[model samples]
Target: MGERTKKQKLILGIQHTLAMFGATVLVPALTGLNTSITLFCAGLGTLLFHWVTKKKVPVFLGSSFAFMAGIMAIIGDSRMGDPDFMEKLASVKGALIIAGLVYVLFAGLIKIFGYEKVNKLLPPIVTGPIIIVIGLRLSGTAINSAFYYNGEFSLKSVLVTVVILTVVICVSIFAKGIFNLMPILFAIIAGYLVCLPLGFCDFTAVREAHFLSFMDKDIVAQLLCIPQFKLDAILAIAPIALVTMIEHVGDITTNGAVVGKNFMVDPGVHRTILGDGLATALAGLLGGPANTTYGENTGVLAVTKVYDPSVIRIAAVFAMILGIFGKFGGFITSIPSPVTGGISIVLYGMISAVGVRILINSRLNFGNSRNLLVAAIILVLGIGCDSIPVYGAVTISGLALAAVVGIILAFILPEGDDSVLN
Candidate 1:
């Protein structure tokens, strides 16, 4: 293979960075964690994954949506009566670190049972609905963020958000060449520019911020470091790993389709799974969000048609470099809540849609009593009774509950001799 041209490398780096922009910052903003550390860990995790996979797949790792419910639960629990939310956030951070190790256990399971056997348990029927629920559940939060709560919605905010989302979606779907590939990036830039006229953003902080710094203290200093091993914390966070593992499988499949190679068979799904597990554990140890492949970056690849893996590696390096700059970290934090909430509405909805799509594509006859019962029970229990009390102390919600219920239903539902779909 010949050396990649400078333009190609630059484009690849930009693509990876752009793909991560929304996700990397959103995790820290929501969890009261360090955005810079999150970016550092995300970049480091992606690099580590590529190393384990022999740099075969052009992919970038970012914060996983699977952990959102877990983080929210932890924060809600810790902050119920606590005076300082930061102190509670610190405890949650410690739990996140411990929970990250659950990935290793799942990786081991994959190694022992192989991907095929695991798939039998978490087929698309289960995973798709889970994904869809992940998105749809979060969509409510997005819409709430985009509007006002004064018994009347803010038309200006709504218009700005819609315009921004429209620009992103339209460019992504209709634009050509490089323009088509950078819809998200372009959308963000366009939104920022619009906000400038409306005084929605104040860059004075960015201007005053130091050009270079270590650990991005402005962001990292907010969350106090309280690293301690707690068994319950570990157990509480561990269940979410199941959902993330399933997501990893989908990411590998998507990356393979983009690069035109069967990564599941090449470096092997087992290796990729193990790599993601190790990376997630490492990130959590440092008080960062669990890492997973960025679907937005995958979309970029589909648009750019540049499948070179090295380009993504370059982007990872850029993220690492940016992680050390307090100014850059602060600038990202300054992104208004409405902007994030606006985009999140789309992102979270997409997650839920993926779950629904899985069931639809499965072609399971809903007319069948068993199928209807399983789906109905799983959806209600997963979404409605999300906060089911377990053993008087533990509570499960959203994707975690959905996954557990789905697995149980899959095993309990009687397999009929007559084929309904056929």
Candidate 2:
């Protein structure tokens, strides 16, 4: 493609922004993080990633689904009322900052040892189930969100969820062009409309919201506190980087293939990983969700055949602009939990499905006892154990613990003839 005019670039940038919008904001909506901050961090992170990569790769960074379980664990159930909610939230931010550092640590390791050694440590067998666990672990939250209203069972909530899911399923399967990639967005719209008649929708926040405030006062207060670095929370959140780092590799590789550029060799995987780490850490510092390379924008690249880094930068700018609009933030935050819950059902399932795809694509032999043991252990430990106590106040549990155990088992279990299918 030839160089395009500014008008063309601006339009393409908006298209890319649209492509990433639904999923990016959804992370904050689900996690109780600020939507504006998530958008700001995502935009800032993309720009930072581009600068780190010398502007060679065409990529956008957005909120990561991988860290959702870990983040929620750190935040804990506010209803319990043990640690104050803001304190718990501060711990989450602290842990995520450390998690981002874990990525930075891996980036340094990859730069020194090469990606191959790190690759062996987290092979498909270990990672696939871990990814599955990330999704399946959150399934309850999705269910509760779908079925409950004001902490009570509501048939009306169920109806709303069904409408959202039905719309999502239909759009994803039957819609053409960009619409095919936007099932969640369409579902939210449908769900919101359905909710209005049933008195499930709330417009009070939207009505009270300013037209152009950058940050809400409550969010500003949260940012003002020092981030608490609890050892247990750090252990919970940091190990997740092991999984997302591998995901970063896949996303970069996919983007490279789409653009016909060897980004791994040019900007180098280490550089890309560093950019991601910095972006994620920035998010943690700013009280936003962790950042990851967005595959959605790459899909836009494939569809539009526009591979320019500058256009991606333009989209990042647009995202930042959107973040500061107070009315927009209120509108998103006002979306009913059940509506987002319905969207989560599909999204969370897809996370697990991605894990299954990884195993299938690698042709890992489940018939082999070693392979079976590794996967079974990861699935059980990850999903079964809510928290396993380690020391006085610390524990290793969930995906982080599962990943650690799986990696050890992968190394310990001797490879048999049928370890992987031929």
Candidate 3:
């Protein structure tokens, strides 16, 4: 292949950055973490992943949705007057640190046992449905935000939201070139623009904000190291590593398909997992969110036909540079909740659709008792019992619960002919 032109490389870099823009900020916004630090770590994580994988596949790392539950649970517990909320947060970080290490362990397992053995356990049948449920679960939040609820829902707001979402979906599916790649970003801008006439957004925060000030000082300090070490905290979060390891496999596979290369075999799954794990641990140590390969950026890659991994490295460099300063962070933090909510409705629904697609593409028999039971149990428990009591100190919610339940059922149930793990 011929070398990429400088302009092509620059375009690729910008596309990757824009693709990850909403998602990279969403994690920190939702979890009350440092947006700048999260972006910094995400970029760093992607670079590290590329390095370990020999720079073969073009994948950008971003915040993992898997840890959303853990973060919410910790924050919720803290709200309930748990005197050890900070301690619990520290422990959660510690667990993630260990979880990152677990990737190395799973990677070794794959090497020893072979990829098929692991694949047999987590076929699209299992993963697809879980992904769907995850999206559907968050859809409610999006819809609610689009239509203001002042103790009563507004029909006008709901109609407006539907229009916004429809426009986004249409553009994503039908638009060509750059338009197709940025459906979400465009949708958000359009939706917020429409809402401007409705008096739904407030720019007061932006006006009060300094043009060149860092966003969240507290988060930045914490990223510099605030939560001290405790063994219990490490143990609490480590179990999540088991599920995220599987997620890493799925991400690599998906990325490989996008780039038309077998990342699992070429750069080798073990090395890729190691890179992800280490980057995640480093992010956690510095009070940033856990990292994962972003599907949004993958969609951009698909749309742009740019397969260069170096573009992601450039994006990462940009993220690190942004992290050093604070004003950019403040600006992102100042984004209106309703605007985020409007976009999230579509993003979350797409996530669910991806899950359904996974199962459909796998051609799994839903009629089978084993398949039905596994899917039913995982969906309900994950979305239903989102909050599970753990040692009378913390609770689990959202993706973390869904993931754990899915893995447990996959392990316990008998594998059918279509099993991905067998």
Deviating ranges (above 4 Å) for candidate 2: 1-35, 50-102, 215-269, 284-319, 389-395
Residues 108-145 of candidate 2 have per-residue lDDT tens digits of: 98899886675577777887787677668767777888
Clashing pairs in 2: none
For candidate 3, write residues 177-225 as lDDT tens digits: 5456456556556766766677666666456544433444555445554
In candidate 3 the C-alpha lDDT for residue 114 amounts to 81
lDDT of 3 at 148: 68
| C-alpha TM-score for every candidate | 0.77, 0.72, 0.75
Best by TM-score: 1
Better of 2 and 3 by TM-score: 3
Better of 2 and 3 by lDDT: 2
CA lDDT of each candidate?
A: 0.66, 0.78, 0.66
Query: In what order do the candidates fall by TM-score, top score first?
Result: 1, 3, 2
Instruction: Provide the RMSD of all predictions against the true structure, rounded to 1 decimal.
Output: 4.9, 5.7, 5.0
Number of the top lDDT candidate: 2
